[model samples]
Target: MAATALAGVALVGALVAVALGTYGRSHTPTGRPLALVIGFTDMAPMKAWLATAGVLLGLAQVLSAAWMWGRLPIRREAPHWLGQAHRWCGSLAFVLTLPVAYHCLWSLGFGTDSPRTVLHSVFGCAFYGVFASKMLALRTKRLPGWLLPAAGGLLFALLVGAWATASLWYFTQPGVPLK
Candidate 1:
């Protein structure tokens, strides 16, 4: 069962990558810059904030899963609230990715101008695909016990990959004033 779930995730991710890659790239501006960021007049800060939040929430999901699975340092089983925290964090992280993804797909589309850009585009597509698989695993009972964590871990890795390739790259640019 776990093997089946893993195969499903891989297939979904591959399909997403192929579909996004085949889509024509659009360089047109989105014209939907977020307003009011304490000294910024553009959407960059908002994008940065959302990406950061999503990454942090992804980290929280990983930690909570560790606790829930008895992989943490603690000897006792995780409390019930840990599960709730994991679910809420995962949901919020997924939600936060929506606007960023919308802007990326709507405004920039997928690109391969650079290694970072290519990585960002590929992982951006995979992130949603893995996320869907994770949510499905969460809802389905017939999947093996290991499948859920595997899906969740894949989602987290994809999120990290996307965030690092884009957000981290943006922040590291010289004289690009974060705020």
Candidate 2:
């Protein structure tokens, strides 16, 4: 139950990050912040579509993580089908993230000299790397092994670190930087 709850929390965190990433967030960057740019700047039709995509992908990830926590009776035995759906959705989410990630790279001016921004870029790239590797493992029918689990573990850790830093800078700023 603890793991399930943590996964749920992570889900909520991901959703919040998606929201803040939207345009016209009304949140300004100050001090050594974690994110270089907020998502909602343009707030036009296209950006709004991207924002919607992000929200959907966030929901998908949350669901996938929840599955990993064993909340569903998908099975500890003879449960490969449901697990495949989760993997499929996760892969779809990866595809959705590409445009958003590219936008972020553009937003950051393609890694000029910002440490936090570069960290965000590195995390995003690594995050996608793990996702792809996990998918490859699943495709090769080599899942349920150490490699897949390790990839997931690393992804979760990166998720936590990135979202935590973003949260600290986004919510706790109170008009100050994340120190």
lDDT per residue as tens, model 2, 97-123: 555554544443233256765565455
Ten contiguous residues with the weakest lDDT in model 2: 24-33
Q: Name model 2 segments beyond 4 Å from true.
A: 1-81, 110-114, 141-144, 165-168, 171-179
lDDT per residue, candidate 1, 1-179, as tens digits? 66776667567656765665556264554555534344554567667778889999999999998988888899888887888888899889888888888777766778678998888988888888776667666665566777777878888888889999988888888877576
* List of clashing residue pairs for candidate 1: none
* Model 1 clashing-pair count: 0
**What is the lDDT for 127 in model 2?**
62
> How good is model 1 by TM-score?
0.83
Best-matching candidate per TM-score: 1
